[model samples]
Target: MGLSSRSVFGLVVSVGLAGAVGAQVTLPPPAPRPEMPEYVPPSQRVDEEEPAFDPSSVEFDPIWTLDEDGKVVGPDGLAEIAALRHNPLITEDLFPIIETILEDRAKEMDTKVFVYPRKAIDALTGAIDNFDVRKEDTRNVMGEIANSLNVSEGLVSWLRDQGLITEEMSMVSFNIMQDYTKRTMDQIAASMPDADQLDLISHQSRFLVRLGLQEPLSAFGRLSRKVLELHPDVVENAAELLELKGRDFLDEVAKALKPLDDDQLKALFKEAYESLHGPVVNSADTDEKIEGKPVGDR
Candidate 1:
């Protein structure tokens, strides 16, 4: 007949206990662990060959890209140039070519010096009326002049700031200032009713110029005297200039000169003069004279 529910449950539990205790079971050897394909070196691999490199498929960027005007366009070119600074060996072979280009550029720039006086006068005419020379703002005015002339104010002030006037001043600034100062003095002379007499006084007495060339420390004193002489009703005292915080353009230039010894000053002056005016001309030989008598007479 049919088994009772309690008897069936006991029979199932007994079977599970027997299996848990000692039943030896096989898992059919894990499906034989399918064999992996034999290892192949990339060189010997035929099915997975790397695609051949195609020159046509590759894209290239130009080292230099130029605009319509032939000027380099993007920072890409500049970056290429800047990268050369670190790898100096790459540039060692390029220096001669670079120097030749620089020499050509310098020659081109040097020719611009001749037009400085006219350009300076034009700039002063437009801007001079608002400039007050009595104040410390004179330096700012000079800076404006420097900007108009494309002469860097930083370059001009470098010697003064570094106290290294023995090196050199910016030639462009020097030439511009020389002409500008002359024009300024001319304007001052012209404002007077006795302009001709004032001009004569200035022309005859180059004492200020000589004093400045001799001792740059005394240069500002010369400027003060010239200003006072030209504008007696305008300026109070030479010492009033000292109130401009002990510094102005002229004061800076004078101070810059103070660091240089006489020999250095002479050398610097000679170099500057030569740069503006070609080499100095040697004097023609003169025959020796005896006792204030001409050599022919003797």
Candidate 2:
């Protein structure tokens, strides 16, 4: 028998619950590196002897000039002077490569900066949800999330105190409130027990209804259904495994998935569908379809 609407909703909620719980897992802090040996002065060094310089073998490659316009004159002299003036060797050629490298490094740093706070928030929320952590901890976590995102939670009160604000300012304030509301809802949902799930859902549904956002919620439901249809078993299996094995299931699944060959995995994926659709007809193959001609005529 086909799954009922209630069953589908339950599945989606179950997945969300697992994600909310899994997000709480805390990773161990990285270990500190060993310190290097202290540096010693050349005069007091005991490691090795310094090499003596040979004055006879030394060569000087001096810059050439004709004493006219103080310009250098020699093979590649113009290029060398230009290199000194503009640092062309570093700027024109290597600068792009250096800039690209720095940009990539900056992106990585930004990712870490964003990710660490998020992880901390998830862990904090999870603790508050499951372990009955203090309300103050939740505030701290929210503060960290705001700080990491470069957002201020005090904007709502600040806007209100302004007495009169622009439409754009009001919209921005509304957006912040919406974001905060969504995040609070997630935390509330995460904290609730299985029995409270329906209650939480009902509360959220009513909230959405009051805000006239039921249509968007329905659209999201439709989009989720489409996604489920595309990969039916993966979602079901993941949910099932998460429920059975708890948090460690993902690690186990990752390890298990690593050994599967591409062809084997493809075969498993193909099994999800009862029958594959035939290749799409190209525009060049037949103008009949494009011209609204009958399939039989084609």
Candidate 3:
């Protein structure tokens, strides 16, 4: 079905600017990020041995099977459970990769960010149903920009009135800007903690935020979008995601992989204590195990 043409002209309010084009936006509650073991830094856990997603190897299940009673079992049931994981191919043990990405992003303290005002009327005409996202998202971004004093919706509307923005492009940009803002700004705030955490957040927070708190998450999101976009049949697009259902999907994948090559991966996970994070040569003799065999655990 096509998106409705009716929502293109909806207005957002700006800092007390009622029904104005751009406005200070309020974001919805963010889901809590699950805690992981603090003993090992995320980078050391996954290390470089972990493989990146192989686009060709991905296979998605089609048509969730159901019994006469509509209950699923066996492989079909397993798939129903697996499908709940965002990308079945990517496992939950891979959370470290995300943290690694966040850590890496911290090095980029000067990434350039642009704030666009709003798209003109002609552009906003047909963007209502593209992703089934809420209209208020745009309002929040508009509010963000307006609060930031970047631009206003009225000005953008005037430009559209002047034939600058095509109707189709307006709404798309309207939501796109909102999306960029919603996804990035707070992430930068959250992942990149202020001075408060430094005395406490371990050195990781400083490095990750400077590198780009949003990079790993962005990389994850990109990979997810790419997988679904490339294989629309095997995956759910943002529309079908419903809510933050992707987290559950990843958890199942983690369970599936928890046992595969366990001893080897566990060994590798622990190897960091020596090779990647060896603090002193003498300390190595203190006591440790490598590959289920004792390094010095005599």
Candidate 4:
């Protein structure tokens, strides 16, 4: 007697319901959590034994060997002998042994100055031997010269580009730039109200040198005269400005002149004059008033 399909299905559903009801039933409380172990910090731990400082010893070959004449013959020995002969401190041998030690000590302390290493000398000689007057090489030489003279390489390059200088004329270009800078500085010093103010003149010269101004100093001299004509008190004004602004005023002036074309530069000079003099009432106005008064009609 096999069970029917419907009876089997009913038996499975009843089993599933029993399992669900069992799962819904409340369980007893969980057991208390186990206690955690205390922490042991690394600093509190015991240290391991340290190893001893013994290093493997090595034997070196002797630098000098005795000759039949009982003379030290190696390179180092020969060098030491040469040093002994040259040393002025070993004048008269007081005690032979002490003199030897003193000579060795002096040789050890005698630092060689102004000496180029053999490899360095060789390299420099090689470079000189291989030197060529190519465009790039010429530019490099010009740049170095310009740097030494405290002028700008760009100025030199510009001069070359303008055909004022050629590759063969690099040194000539440098001399010209140097002369220009000196002449410009001298002109500026002369144009100053107090040419004897060396410190002030030096400051101005350094400023110009840093700017590497390409224009002739006569242009600047003319500009200075124009400034004075517009405002006779410009020197006093400059002193006040310097006191208030320190180097900033000079820096700003340099910046303004840096990119100016010739026309723009001339306009700038005129504008500076007009700006200073524009606000002042004419002396003719006061004169006119006095003249109209009819010589103090009493």
Candidate 5:
């Protein structure tokens, strides 16, 4: 079977069968790959007429394979990756380069910072399943998160049915939901016939933006009050908001997530993965089941 967050772990022995008992699996040895040259040119090669035979050789990594009947034939690529987590063979000398080529992918992904409503983000966090490349379920699952944040409610029932969002995570994501709702309310209030209130509300959004540059907590409340004055309606239900206990929550979250930028997270993710799992094989051939056809793409 292919890999996934659910079936990704397995490192134990039995007792009476007495070791670990969990959902897990494995596969065969890999093929050796051809050594890549340091450099070459079209013109230089043609002139020599010499069959540019190579003398140097290096140990190659085996390629994982599968069969027509869908049987995993070779050592699982994912399993190899998993084992590398604790292996010593992967080293700086052997492997080095690793990072996502597309930086903008972060905005495209359905991660929490980008997702709205927050429930969709919760869903992905809760999922633990075997993956099928033919189904391309990971993208679909993530898209659900994006849609929810975007206010596209069509997938709501599917989300619930799929158990994408667990009860615990859903409640956590509700913080995000409430935050968006509050932002929406602010927008609506800003759109009212009252010009002064609209400007005031807009002011809050600006202050929130500028909050990143400001030293934490130094003048936060003052700016917040100014924003409130510009859009006083936010405080119109001060008693209810206070009862709801959402104000401090919002402030706390803003502070916590504010400094975290995409580049930093991307680098960190790659760094951590490399630290645990040998090195990430970026630019390698990734298998994609496109329209039921298995194809390799970089």
Candidate 6:
């Protein structure tokens, strides 16, 4: 063993060559460490069998629903639909009231009753019955005004610009105005003698003509004119009274008329009627003129 130096040197060289060969061999990166799943408590774990999102499974609320018009299906919309469905203008039997009012008028007028065409009664009756419809329309308009940022906000802005209305009082005024209008409508509908009022309107030839011509809104406007002509003092102070105390104004108006007998009422109606239509032109007046003419002129 001591004499084998050449053999020992060859063995060392073989060991060095094996180490170099192992270093030269490239190994793939140790397979990336497998990631651990995040720990979840038993109570917090989502079940694997749970269903995915489904819209139908959710509860429906009409308030949140968008209608065909892109507006919310709110309580107001529902009420309007119901109101239109049950409106007396469309649904109620108005013919009975019309016949009754006509019969009463005929008894009073005798031969003169024939002068009023059936169309006049139809117009007046329709207007009276449609009062509820008009009220509903007014409520909708007011609701729209209140809901619209542009209109309501514009009112506030305009009031501020005027320097007459304080910001706090502007909204108060708006609310009060709405309340006054609603109360005024209620008083007029409840206290004004419906039958007598109908009769009063029946005598106004111009009012009937206007209503028959499909100018109901204009006919209503002229009603205010007639009221002014009849009671100028009452109307002059109406705005102030309405703002301060709206409920009693129309009641007082109704009470004032209670003292008049039939003859007195007819006289008032005649004045109003004549003022509205002028003197009734007739063939008799024309005949008088024609007969008075000179023969040669004729």
How far residue 292's Cα lies from its native spot in candidate 5, in Å, is 18
Off by over 4 Å in 3: 1-199, 203-213, 232-239, 242-298
Off by over 4 Å in 6: 1-250, 280-298
lDDT of 5 by residue, 169-270 (tens): 333333333333354445545456565753555444333322221211212222223333333353344333223222343354233333446554334333
Tens digits of per-residue lDDT for model 2 on 1-298?
9999999999999998899788996658999988988998888977567654332232223333234554333222121222222321123554454444434333322222222322222332342233212345544654443333221212223223443333333444344334434654565466565636556665554333222321112222222232234554544354444343322442333333334455543333233211222223352332233233211123
Model 4's alpha-carbon lDDT is 0.37
My TM-score estimates for the predictions, one after another, are 0.19, 0.18, 0.16, 0.19, 0.18, 0.19
Q: What tens-digit string does per-residue lDDT give for candidate 6 at 196-244?
A: 6543333342222322232212222232234446755643454443333
What lDDT score goes with residue 113 in model 6? 13
lDDT of each: 0.37, 0.37, 0.32, 0.37, 0.32, 0.36
RMSD after Cα superposition, model 5: 32.8
Which model, 2 or 4, shows the larger lDDT?
A: 4
Q: Please report how far candidate 5 places residue 168 from its true position, in Å.
A: 25
Error of 6 at 252 (Å): 3.4
Candidate 2 or 6, higher TM-score? Answer: 6
TM-score of 3: 0.16
Candidate 2 regions exceeding 4 Å error are 1-150, 153-169, 172-298
Q: Which ten residues in a row have the lowest lDDT in candidate 1?
A: 283-292
How would you encode candidate 1's per-residue C-alpha lDDT over 1-298 as one tens digit per residue? 9999999999999998789667676445556777899999998978768775433332323333456854433222122222232222233555465444434333222222222223233332333333333444643654444432332222224333434222222333343333334554454455465646644454423322322222111222333333333444432343454444322434433333444455544344434434544663431211121112311232
